[model samples]
Target: MNSTYANGTVHRYEEIKFVPPSNNHKTEVQSKDVTILPNKNVSARLYLSKISRKNKKFPLFFYIHGGGFCIESTFSSGYDSYLHKLTAQANVLVVSINYRLAPVHPIPAYYDDSWDVMNWDARGKEPWLKQHANFSRVFLAGDSAGANIANNIMVRASEESHFVLSLVGMALLDPYFGNGKPDVLWTYLCPKTNGIDDPRFNLAAHPKILSKLKCSKIFVFTAGKDNLRDRTWTYYETMKKIGWKGELGIKETEGEGHVFHM
Candidate 1:
């Protein structure tokens, strides 16, 4: 790994421009940004499918983006296109966070930003969530490093007695995890952690913490060809081992790689 983690790493490869929220997907979906954490310049875009808008209520799908916790934004061109597809198909009102990333910001900084957004909206501070979101149907979801944040937030929410918006489920998509090679990335992103053995990077390493996850319906999707497949599977198995009483599901698609859903 490079001794100079910030300027010389993958985290510095930022998008040149943030694509504005658009209803131009030519689909029956409307989207706009809502501020969650003003001090951090953190916010999320809300996408409402025609059905959801008409019905005036829908499942709350709060998404954390995957960018190795470094270079990507939910408003990036690729993610914007992908978000359109997700909103159109899921028929759910989706809120994707623009959480702070790593290298420039570092580990728990990324996690803190995400947790703040979730905790804020859940308290009814965000109008979109308060008016139309079904708190009972709330699901925390993400891909790759975003998925990592999703898991962490759920556990933290469970521990906070004041966090009343219950998370019903979580969809972890092609999560970037491991005990070896990816440790370099985690150390670079987190800096404060003790490498691969860190609970954040290796969920299986901490059964007690894994047991803290409160969602009842857990869904994990992994690409068969994804290098992180074994690590993702380990997380699922460990959740079961911890005696987590939930409906657990896993879908592995052969010949696919990381974040293929995008």
Candidate 2:
């Protein structure tokens, strides 16, 4: 499939095979193994790369990889490619997290770990942060289930005025929610449990939190064929109705399905 960007540049989707990170070697980007002490110790990892040192303060982009809250990790090449692209394009410090997964950790556990990492990063103020990671210009970007976690963090950050006071933008890649749709279809289609009413996956349940978020820019990318397409649009409309003064970029990828961004 092909899509034309605002710059009039045409881009085509090609099949790209990824090799998972091996124990023996590391990619060009150096990742540090760290455990977030959130209430209980949360097992997590951070991928770090310094883009530039000329600027005293650089923007930080926290990324959450998507896999239906069950199967993907920050080490996956699909996520690695996304991080590399962001590092080259934005000149910001990108950290991809491996939060605890579902069916084992369940709902709120993922949200908890995400918030924990955000808080951990907030307290540490990494050295690169002084030279490259901008504490005031942070952005949250994620895909699929990761997008759900990112949105939750944004809500929590706004509510508690925690670590994300500097959040200026958010990019949700195909967020999944029910939006009052028939549960039967969602249950039949999705491999995981289709508990659309679950606070983690349901956006309407957190209207107050969503309203409190002060993001100036929001980008939601969804494929026309995705079941979650309507939910993404609904959330965008909800943000507008709640008087969020932000620019929303809703791009519908033609002839693509869910997880197309990955």
Candidate 3:
């Protein structure tokens, strides 16, 4: 997606390809959109597996969709399909955030909605969540740029005491962390950012930050053939070097490239 920014506004010159969210007919997973901001028509997609026990609550899977802080959405077919299968197989209630995109809203705008969703007392706000979601076992998962958002949320949660949810773990699938250099897409979305070395994009620069993650465990997945592979490795090594108290799991797919599993 190509974009031009000027005077606090951005214009995109390309037509982005997108597929609307839909439930797979063959799967037992059912999904629906829930309103987040009725005035703005902002919403999120919720996925539940029909095979689940009638009265038992399942772990909550709060997911953020990846599109480089620009394109894609929770309503996109790719994400919808993946979350459907994931909800069914993992036996978790999937709450996929559909944050505002860039070329209009920009970086922190996307992050803000995600942070709000993460902090929402869902059990008190939504009936389905109250009945079906086990908030005590909340897990945050995302791929690529979404993973970046997930990590930033974790870091921010580490520094704040007001977060309401208890996160058991976080899963980062081919996170989009960058090396020590300016990134075009990132700099575009975060115009005032201090380049790619900003703590949001470069966790290695802030070694102690990893130790303060609010979660008890973390799982990071990387594709060996991905361009961002080394950056993920750097992040993993930094976590180890900091002697982070949380349990850590790292996995790499030898012949794949960025988010291949998705």
lDDT of each structure?
A: 0.80, 0.69, 0.81
Clashes of 1: 0
TM-score for each prediction?
0.90, 0.77, 0.91
Ranked by TM-score, top first: 3, 1, 2
Best by TM-score: 3
| Model 1 spans > 4 angstroms off | 1-11, 14-17, 51-55, 180-182
Q: Clashes in each model (backbone N, CA, C under 3 Å)?
A: 0, 2, 0
Better of 2 and 3 by TM-score: 3
Q: Pick the candidate with the highest lDDT.
A: 3
What is the TM-score of candidate 1? 0.90
Error of 3 at 139 (Å): 0.3
Give one digit per residue, the lDDT tens place, for model 1 in 32-143: 9888778888888888777534437778888988978766888888888888888888877788899876566777887888888877777865666667777778899999
Higher-scoring candidate on lDDT, 2 or 3: 3
The Cα RMSD of model 3 versus the native structure comes to 2.2
Model 3 per-residue lDDT tens digits across residues 1-262: 7555566656655454556556666777778778877654567888876744676788888899887777777876678777888988898888998888886776787778888776663534776687878878888889999999999888887788866677889999999997786677778778798888988898899887777897999999998898889988999999998898889889999999888986
Runs with alpha carbons beyond 4 Å of true place in candidate 2 = 1-31, 38-56, 162-164, 182-195
Q: For candidate 2, lDDT tens digit of each residue in 49-121?
A: 5433456455778888877666677766787666665665565667677787554555667788888788778
